[model samples]
Target: MNKRGKVVRDTNAGTGLISIDGQQFPFELEGMWKSDVAPCVNMVVEVDFGADGRVASVQVVPESQLAREQAEAAMRATKDKGAALGKEMVARFGAGTLAGMAALVCGWFVFNTITVQIAAGYSSGLSFWKVLGVLNSPLGFMNALGGAGGGSGAYGLFAVLALCGPLLPFFVRNPLAHLANLLPLLFIAAVCAIGYFGLMDGLKQAQGAALAFGGRQAAAMAAEMASGMMKEALRAVSFGLGAYLSVLASLYFAGRGAIKYLSSRA
Candidate 1:
């Protein structure tokens, strides 16, 4: 005989009880179904009786109550896993590690941006080496506070923006989790800007200068300028690529650490 009922474990006796309607029947839960359906309290279950009248098997009836119980169990398991991972991270890396790493990454990103911009500026003939030296220094970051009036001023502002990009995410804890997703696109934009403005523009200017000179001297000077521009463009490309890759790598690692920290905190 098979009857639908709710499972009730007798804690003192360490046995199973089935409550059906107003009556209670004692039964021995059998099969792997016993453990599988163990935690679903008050859930409707099918109790099968053997010919000898002992309980043969127990199975949970699929219903809204059972679904809700399963969902709750899954949520609990997920929370437990998250807590365990958080504890492990704290034990291994400590609590403040993520914040420290983020600061280091931000500093590196700012430094890399400054260096790349300086190299590109030199290639474009927009600034001399001495100016590039000052701009590449730590004090150059102060330029970010200044206004954008001239070309170099605009470049300085760009440098400041680049410095802020990785660091700003750290200030807004919620968005730091998504920095990895944004780094690839940011790297691509940096490469394209470096290629067009730093390399292609310089080549165009050299072509224009060649056109203005006239005769064999003009041809020789234009060739020399074009060659120089090409060399500088290659150098700028290398610097841009290096800076972007380094920043992207830093962001990737820092983003992961931030995610772990946030998940554990939550």
Candidate 2:
């Protein structure tokens, strides 16, 4: 007798069973077949039954053919879905690929401009106009790269570094289109570091002065001032991070939308 079904094994019960068209039959898996194929649950196989009605031999189906079929099916489904999405986007956005690209560029420019202004103003305590001016100047972004007190030579070095930054993305392939992408984050970090150190220095000075006065009340006052400074620094850091993330989110959506529109035209 011959039967074709899926193999199932109950490890806890130490028994093997074959299920065929909703019918299950107890079977003893042959040991010789185990050398060529390991018995696994849910694997389809052909079984040869002895005259006593017990399984005498089993031939497990090769999984490679099934795997290949499944992979091809998945690829077809993905292609179909992509085609449908492309058509829908074209119908909605029209076939203006150049317009979509232009929109993306404009959106990125606006976002970058806003991010620079916020980061520079927060870090340097400069007005929006001054930050904008600095960003527009060829040497401007270099000045904002690090903290103050650098000599002319140091400034020149930073300028070179800044100029070389954008070229980095061309050399590297994985993620991060340009080093400029990290400018906003670096600016925020620099600002926070400055603020934190300044606060710590002030607190230390205040504590030293209070200790000189020689009273528990003075110590209490020093502690209070330190706490207040920490809270203010935290608030500033939070606000800067929030603003940066918001700008990044806007840029991401604009870029993604533009790409989608352009792809629809293809």
Candidate 3:
């Protein structure tokens, strides 16, 4: 029987190796080639095995056959990957493709959905993936979240943790890994608090600057206007569905982790 392989190299005048099914087999270019010249590197060839299961002869396969074989190989590879992925999912979830389902849900509601709609704010309506990218840049976060700069960007750090820290538990061993259950909740809390405080801090600075320029005489009016300013500020920032959905995801992670942990203990 004959097999197909790509020529790996023409090492010398009459000797070389070819890769077949990912294994390299040496072939003699002497009388076995059947061609005037030995096959060039990267050329596909048909191989005949000897009684000892060694390479007997090799010749270039037809172009049509090469193309058909390549397509078939690609299809086989894709099927193999899909089968492997399905098996892994079943091993982990004990059922269907739970991971794929979660990813699809998250991709729609969390990754692609609008995070917030900011009428004038920088952080408005951007997808979750972009928000994650900008969270690392202090000025970027401030600009995106408020269209203003100067916040310590502590929320951005928490946001990073909220987005990425959950994966740690899956990779680490138990006990410590168990923290994944509660960590998401903590991260979400910390991010909310820090984000709110950062905004308030910026607002206060603006108010103080107003008082500084207006002098003590304007303090009365500043105090009078403070309540309205706070109201307007709160009204300007409306949370979008994606933001809420993201929190729900984090909550789900925590709840599921807790269930698994408790079940293990039981």
Candidate 4:
């Protein structure tokens, strides 16, 4: 039987008890309740009965509609918040300035590196390690131009450069904490670059010796390659400080714009 009822006892059931024609039936609520609005006690509801006359489907009527409206209102509020955030972002970065800069930097690296790798008969695929290598050292830039390097080095280099970028300003403002920030990137790159180069050099030497025993010139070639790799590692350590400085400059400019906008608005 199809009937309409009002919820009597809530009692924490998936469906609540309802009074229908002066009779109480255990009824289950269908679907989900909306956040911020819920079915009220004694709210009118519709129910379908099973063969045994038990409630098959129970739905709160007017209260459910109220819940739906509340949910939509909440969604609208969230959209407004998102719009405000967008406006704040635009004010801080000057509406595409940061985006354009990012595109330029990434594009320059990709275009240069991809072209060289393609010409060298390497597959036209990007390598994270290679990118890191470039970031860590001048050798990393060289790798993009057909030198040997990887992502670990590139990440290290970027880190080092970023750390050094804000040193002078920070030192002038707060010597102790600012100074601590300045050379961390370089130090990190140094440790990583040293470890990587050392491990690779040892491996190459071992391979070269094995090949030379078979009358190949592998050992001599590997030894020569090791010197160049070692040189790149050293260069990476030296240039880390410069890269850190550039990153700090970028962040400082971005932050300055944000502060100016906020002060003006205030």
Candidate 2 per-residue lDDT over residues 1-266, each given as its tens digit: 77778877732365588787798877654452432666778988877778987667777867786789789999999999999998885775445433432333333222232222235355433322223334345255446434321233433344334323333444565344443434333443443465457557868888888878967788788889788867765554322333444345434434554454455456
Models sorted by TM-score, best on top: 3, 1, 4, 2
**Candidate order by lDDT, highest to lowest?**
3, 1, 4, 2
Q: Decide which is better by lDDT, 1 or 3.
A: 3
Model 1 agreement with the true structure over 140-259: per-residue lDDT tens digits: 523532321123344345544543444444456564443543443353355446545655665666667777778568867887878886777455533433344445555664566567
Name the candidate that leads on lDDT: 3
Query: How far out, in Å, is residue 223 in model 1?
Result: 3.6
List where candidate 4 sits over 4 angstroms from the true fold.
1-61, 101-207, 215-266
* Superposition TM-score, candidate 3 onto the true structure: 0.54
Q: Count the backbone clashes (under 3 Å) in each candidate.
A: 0, 0, 3, 22
Better of 2 and 3 by TM-score: 3
Give lDDT tens digits, candidate 4, residues 42-105.
8777777779866676666676677897899999999999999978867764554445344334
Per-model TM against the reference: 0.31, 0.28, 0.54, 0.31
RMSD of each: 17.6, 18.5, 7.7, 13.1
| Leading candidate by TM-score | 3
Off by over 4 Å in 1: 1-192, 215-221, 232-245, 248-266
Q: Any idea what lDDT model 4 has? A: 0.53
Tens-place lDDT per residue, model 3, 76-176, is 99999999998875776545225433542464235533444355544455444444444445457546445342333555455555555455555676755
Which lDDT values do the candidates have, in the order given? Answer: 0.54, 0.53, 0.64, 0.53
